[model samples]
Target: MTDVSVYTDPQAAVPTAPLIETRKLTRHFRVGRGLSPKMLHAVDDVDITIDRQEIVALAGESGSGKSTIARLLAGVYTPTSGEIYFQGRAVSSMRSRRDQLAYRGDVPMVFQDPFSSLNPAFRVSHGILRSLKLHQPELTRTQRNEEAERVIEAVGLAPASDLMYRYPYELSGGQRQRIGFAQALAHKPKLILADEPVSMLDVSIRIGLLNLMAELRRSAGVSFLYITHDIASARYVADRLLIMYAGHIVESGPTEAVLANPKHPYTDLLLGAVPDPRAPLSVAVEGDTGEPPKVIDPTPGCRFRWRCPLVVDECHHVTPTLRLLGDGHEAACHVAEPDAGMHATKP
Candidate 1:
């Protein structure tokens, strides 16, 4: 596992306060607008922390409320309950437009679809210039252009001045995605909420972007909340891995430890689901094919109980909170031992 302890070091010069944190962070949507409206619990009571320059991957299935958490942190969606803290300051306290703009500058969001995120009508420079103008008003037009060129080049886009003049339609998917990163960089952000940033790119190109993220963290001291469903990619770039399911963070720990010895039944199932390329082409893969449940206005029991192969009697009645198993690894499961999934059997 390459001694993941270095990444988990408690003496890594972490700030007195986390760069970003969510305390019991939750968000619910009103699905039905009729006389009897029902709340769709998209995200429920998730607590996470991102230290300066740390890469934390939030991995799960597609509808696992991963993007909702990103949106909440990006200020695109208001949290239904709970609070978000940036640099130890409550996000709710930033009520004024100036405060909100400042916060957004410090924490920008790079979305999933590179094509849709940028304006087709405008050149690649539009988004970057807009961000710089809003975040760095002191910069003149010429300085903004220079800064934009520097950012474009920084993201590995060659001939930055030439590329900046081209429209979004002129660029490849990877190039457009680099532009997205450049846009975020224009704000000089401290952290970025990256929602499936590399999922849309070619398998070959994905590594480049992941490497870029690591480089950004190494050089610029930028932090990231990397949201994705690909466990392999998460394992590759993230120092910490957080497994989310049914609006709950089911498992979290240092990436290698959690993946090497997953404690929760759900986490075990998730790892089992990852396709093994080394296996024989003729060999059939086996595991439960059940899908994650859609959480609505619900009861108190564990949400994963229905899909869990190792569901216990306690899981049917009591919602399990994250308990420290050992070495900072935690899971929300009633029947799982600290070392339960080290040699987990396929269900």
Candidate 2:
């Protein structure tokens, strides 16, 4: 394992204030019949902060509330409780239309499906031109078109003139995704919510996109919230990692430290699942059986207790909060407390 301190330097010269922050952000939904509707806790008391130019990766299984958090940050969904602060202003307090539009312009999203994001009716340049018109309305048509071509080229699409006329169906998956990045860059956004942007692309093309994003962060100083299940890719791009489970962030810290010495059982499980060529064929790593616990009207104890291998009596009664481990690392597990010897191990 490479030393994280030498490789990932997210903390170097970081600003004191965060670019975006959440204070006990909670979002719930009502499901089932009207007689007794269940409250689904999609995000429960998630407090996170992202500094400028920092790449923070949110990793978890599907339906673990990663996308929900992204949506909340992108202003796609309203939170039931708590607040989302961007540049020290409350997102919910932006009552005026102008304020909302300004907020949207500052924070753009790059969705998972590149094909669906780009409209087939419009050319590749049309999407970026539209964003330019919306955000940089003062610019003339000629200026907007030039800006579009520049952004397109910046995302690695060469010969912008030729590619601008191509439709979504005319471009390959990688090209279409590049167009998505170009569109996001049109607004010169301060932060981007990348929700599994590389998951749908081919393995060969994924690295290129990751490198593109990393380059963008370096050149543009844009903060990113990269949501994905692929821990390996997260480690490659992200400076820090936040592990989500059952709608809660169970563990968070510097990416390599968490990977090298996972404090939470769920984090350990996720790392154990990663493929290792050196391991024997007969030696298999297995996760907990049974479906994940229902989020609707969840019990008081730890959300992961039902599936946790280190479940103890206290885990069933006490809802563990994120406690500091060391050097900004935190975990929400009673058994895997900071002082406990819960080092990385196969699950």
- The candidate scoring highest on TM-score is 1
Q: Best lDDT goes to which candidate?
A: 1
Residues 196-220 of candidate 2 have per-residue lDDT tens digits of: 9999999999999998888888777
Candidate 2: lDDT over CA atoms?
A: 0.86
Off by over 4 Å in 1: 1-15, 289-291, 340-347
Whole-model lDDT values for every prediction: 0.87, 0.86
For model 1, residues 1-347, the per-residue Cα lDDT tens digits are 01111122232223588988899999999887879999999999999999888999999998889999999999999998999988788999999999889889888999999989999999999999999999999999999999899888878897887999999999999999989998998888889889999999999999999988888887667889999999999999999999999899999999999999898877887888888899877776555555457598878888887777677688878989999997989999887687556434546
- At residue 136, what lDDT does model 1 achieve? 93
Clash pairs of candidate 1? Answer: none
List candidate 2 segments past 4 Å from native.
Answer: 1-16, 280-282, 339-347
